[model samples]
Target: MRKLIAAGAAAVALAAPAGAEFASDPAQHLMRIERDALETVSRDRLQRLMRAAAEADEDVVRVSYDGDWLAGQAAPDGGAEWKCLSEALYFEARGESVRGQFAVAEVILNRVESSVFPDTVCGVIEQGTGELYQCQFTYTCDGAAETIHEPEAWAQVGKVARAMIDGAPRALTDGATHYHTKHVSPRWAGVYPRTATIGVHHFYRKPVRVSSN
Candidate 1:
């Protein structure tokens, strides 16, 4: 009879949920955050889970990606991905309308999706960050301190970054993977197809080809 009992206790141990792991793992923290938001999981256990996740920068954005949840969102908790997006919006389109800001975010997100660019937001934005003037974005290599003196602007842009990171739709730039402000027209602008003009910026995308027999 004992020999016929398959795996018994050992199998049960393997099946135990990831509850014990919630303390040290950020992935576990995300699960805990979702559970806590729903208020359906072990509430007391979630407190510890959340504490673990909040210690890291990337996982905090998991809970407050929506604009409505800004009240509980902590901007400093953002990891490098969030920082890149927020800084881009701040320097590129903070003066533009909210729609335009989102449009810029859309462009950055589009770059992430494209095969030519990096797979992650941070990688795309920081592609040319260290070069003198060849950096993809001007602010990165322009020698200005990447400081946030405008709390209000930072907060708003933080929300935009979170929104974009959470897979927000990309409609503003017409799938544009590149953009330049109206003040300067780079030589590449003539080669790349102009997709749309949003606020002070001109958006562009590489032309799609139709195969001809």
Candidate 2:
């Protein structure tokens, strides 16, 4: 805090005019100028801080079903893990509602937190990749190209993935570590307890920890 204040003060002082009046009361004149500089910097800094707070408050909002909130965010530029999460959302749940997309992110993240799954998003999502039809996520080994054709949709889910990675709440999934689309009923779904039903997917978390391969 002190560093910020000092930097703000220095910036205000440096930006001020170099010329000074030759006053008879030189000491008082210098003191007054310093006081004015301090006041100006403090006021400007406070206003900037307040505006930043307001903007940040607006940036993160409820993930709406219509995807209205996504327009406010850019596609996240992150590492491989981020890309993996975004891709999973793109192939698996991009057409889902915004809430549904976030719910999927939540399930992936929840699995990361579980002892039964890999400790990272990519590790969990791409598990069982070498064995066809054995992958945790179908997109990884379904023999189809993992190409992303929808740039806008990718950007939206990228924002969702980044938000989830940055500690966004997982309220929708209810601690689910597994989910499958409504079209297919995997045998595992019957074994695991249902936690949520978001959009076209049914979510579940295993009743007990299972060994991760």
TM-score of 2: 0.68
Specify the highest-lDDT model's number.
2
Give the lowest summed-lDDT range of ten residues in model 1: 3-12
The sequence of per-residue lDDT tens digits that candidate 1 reaches over residues 1-213 is 443333433344355576755433444455555567778546767887887776754533343333465556556337889888999999877887677788888888888888778998888888888878888888788888888788887888888877778666676788998899899999989999998897898999967565696
Candidate 2, 84-119: lDDT as tens digits: 999999999999988999989988898898887899
- Candidate 2 positional error at 14, Å: 55
Q: What lDDT score is found at residue 15 in candidate 1?
A: 57
Q: Per-candidate TM vs. native?
A: 0.62, 0.68
Residue pairs with backbone atoms closer than 3 Å in model 1 (clashes): none
